[model samples]
Target chain A: MRSFDGVYEGFRAPVSSQKRSLPDSHNPAVNMASVRYISKVVKALLTFDNLIWYSSVKYVLRRCEEMKSGGAKALLSFVRVLVNIGWYAYLIVAVVTIIGIPHLLFRDYLPADKPMPWMEHQPGYTITFSDAVSAEGLASFARYGLVLGLPNLLIMLFILHNLRRLLAAGIENPFTLENARRMRIIGFLLLAGVAAEIGVNLITARFVINNVHIPGATIRANPLPYRGGLFSALLMLIVSEVFKLGVLLQEEHDLTV
Target chain B: MTIAVHLDRLLVERKMSLTELSERVGITIANLSILKTGKARAIRFSTLEAICRELDCQPGDLLEYVEDGEQPS
Candidate 1:
């Protein structure tokens, strides 16, 4: 039973005796100081780690000092030029759509048997006021949607394309304060355009519908909403004013930045 | 329209090889070859500095003016 166990036990006693013979000076102050030092070291390490993590996140989200060395400003200016081009193009489309409205509305007033001067031939058939009003309402809806949606969509696409190109070029300039402000202004303009259209439709719907009725013919106004051309034009003016204000605000912000 | 670089001549006079010079100057052999053959559009001041430092010569020593119909100067 006491084969090699007694010898191993004898060797363990010397190591335990040595440990026990060490000075047992248990000072609470010294222990607390050691604990405080360890805690301070841990806190410093944690702070350094946090700093690195935050800087890395900022580098990914926004263009840090290093990645802004390329032609970021030039690219943004080019994007602005593209936006202006798109705005002018949409303006041209809106003007053309507006010019066509009169012709579309007055097609029935032209001589039926004889071809009108502008018409290539008689408009296939005579269109009543009720039919004309319904068609005008649909056309107005289409034009309003186009005028409100196309320019903004084009600008957004341009921004997205440039953003992708910048990312591909390894240049990170996203989330800049200027860019965020510009985006907010664009959103405001789009929302204002929509609101203006809704307001005009609400106010002028009954007037345009009532005025288009045939005398003594007892034709009911097409139950559909209608906004007069002049009122729509006025709304467009208001939207344009909002757009101009937004542009001015954005430019002022850019200058200040 | 054409600017000739006399790097090859300088390298030969200094008893240096293209590979050795490229390695000492920290530039690719291909770029050094292009510089020597006068096919490069532009060279940076830093690269020029490194090359001059490694070759123990000035930039003018590595570049020479050759008139259109005249011999190299």
Candidate 2:
């Protein structure tokens, strides 16, 4: 039986050799083994390929880092960050001043009644000093100022912080994704604030008509006219939105390229 | 502004195609083109090694130092 087994093994070896030498035909088990081996080889090759790619990427990153730290590049980046921070600080001051000035001047005049027009053809309104001192009028002025000024101030601060980060990072271009994000946020806030202001004026007009009685009317009595202070504030807010849109466009262009 | 690269002239002298050299050196065609066109701001030693090996030349052959006001004839 052992001799018969050895003869069978020898026959099997020759048949396997013959099959390998043939052009097309192969055993199912042999084919499976070959497939496994090829797959293994491919995986090994892929590992090495990935290693090379990773090394190249690392090299490029290192080069960029080196450039970022270089003399003029580093100085420029610092300057840009400084300028951005300064600009935002200025904006904050401006917004605060604008909001604060009106309150400071008119704090005593709270809920100043809608002024009575003097001439039928003349288009001017006046707020008396007595009306500004009332409790409800003061509350109204404070609320208006806080609502309009706080958001603008906050937006400026947000932009300032992002710009500071970009500058410290030595980013080649300061206007990047970070600034774009902040601008979009500020834009939406500006729109909301403006809308809210419009709402407040509408509510204020209604309150004035129902609560206080005006004695004499000369010209048309629109509580809030086209050239009213609230109208100007809304226009300014709209302009800010436009500015944000411009900034967003510039950011998009940079990202696209 | 003062430094210049002479990779293109060297490649021309070696009578080797950029594609052939790229394949042999295991560098991308884009990088090789960048080097040849002198658009590359810097080169890595490993890349230099590969290029030297593929072209059968030294780094000196690929990179020539020309003085500030000197023009390559």
Candidate 3:
């Protein structure tokens, strides 16, 4: 009886008083109530698998409420920092990619022992050669870095710059026309990136891949942009349109007296 | 845009300034100015009711349909 007190304590009156009224645990109603409460508790515990899950859910909801109140600002600021860091890292990689061009030009004049910093293998292709790979084949590796890398770097820089500005503006007012414009521009840039990727792949396959040969080698390459990029670009465009609608709604809300 | 807000005219007829109307309607002066200038995209029913109650005018009296090429007075 005293142990059952902990189970139904919150829902019912204190254990001593309730037991005094009950007279005996054999009372059918009392027995049923105790069984029902015990079953409910057991069910909840079983549903959660363990006590950790119950406490974890409670903690997460409390944290979520805290974030809803004011933690979102901290999260946004953290995201801004991460975006900037990513842009800086990408710039460094772009610089490395560009370095391959000069190395390709004056590779003999430079140290021959050093490995090429360029992207020698593209994403979609595998090549096998019986004889020695030609100089043209090696040069095409460096050319691959330039053709695809430069456009990608430029597009990413624009996208990141717009995103940085959009976040800064969004902190003040997320549904502003400027934010909508930034979203639209970002969407367009993503589409442009897809176009550039496909174009570069096609041009490379036509001009560079043709020259890149070995005596009895089979070169298999797909001159097509990845579907993921295309999907993302289209998704971004849809998001941009939704952001425009949000901006319009925000304007109407602001004007409402 | 063809539906012109006659809030300024209503305020003028009532001999009430925008600030006075804004205070009477319990709405912000800036929001009243937006409504007055006909720059508001849509008016909420609650806001329109508040404005109408203060101005002692019907919603129709405060808003009028103007022909596309005709200038609102």
Choose the strongest candidate by TM-score.
3
Clashing pairs in 1: none
User: Scoring model 1 with DockQ, what do you get?
Assistant: 0.01
The regions of model 1 sitting more than 4 angstroms off are A1-148, A172-257, B1-3, B13-15, B40-60
Poorest stretch of ten by lDDT in candidate 2 chain A: A114-123
lDDT (C-alpha, whole model) for all candidates: 0.56, 0.59, 0.73
For model 3 chain A, the run of ten residues with the poorest summed lDDT? A1-10
What does fnat come to for each candidate? 0.00, 0.00, 0.82
Model 3: lDDT of residue A189: 94
Give the per-residue Cα lDDT of candidate 1 at A209. 60
lDDT of 2 by residue, A156-235 (tens): 56555544554565545544455445445544554554555556566566555544443454323344433443454455
Indicate which candidate wins on DockQ.
3
Quote model 2's TM-score.
Answer: 0.32
DockQ, each predicted model:
0.01, 0.01, 0.50
* Top candidate when judged by lDDT against the true structure: 3
A1-257 per-residue lDDT for model 1 (tens digits)? 11233433553565566666454336677778878999999999999999999998885545434336635665555455555676566657656766765554443322223211221222343323443344335435444544544454444444444333433332243434444344444445444444555555554555456534434455333333234533553554465466456656654443320
TM-score values for chain B across all models? 0.88, 0.82, 0.90
Instruction: Supply the global lDDT for candidate 2.
Output: 0.59
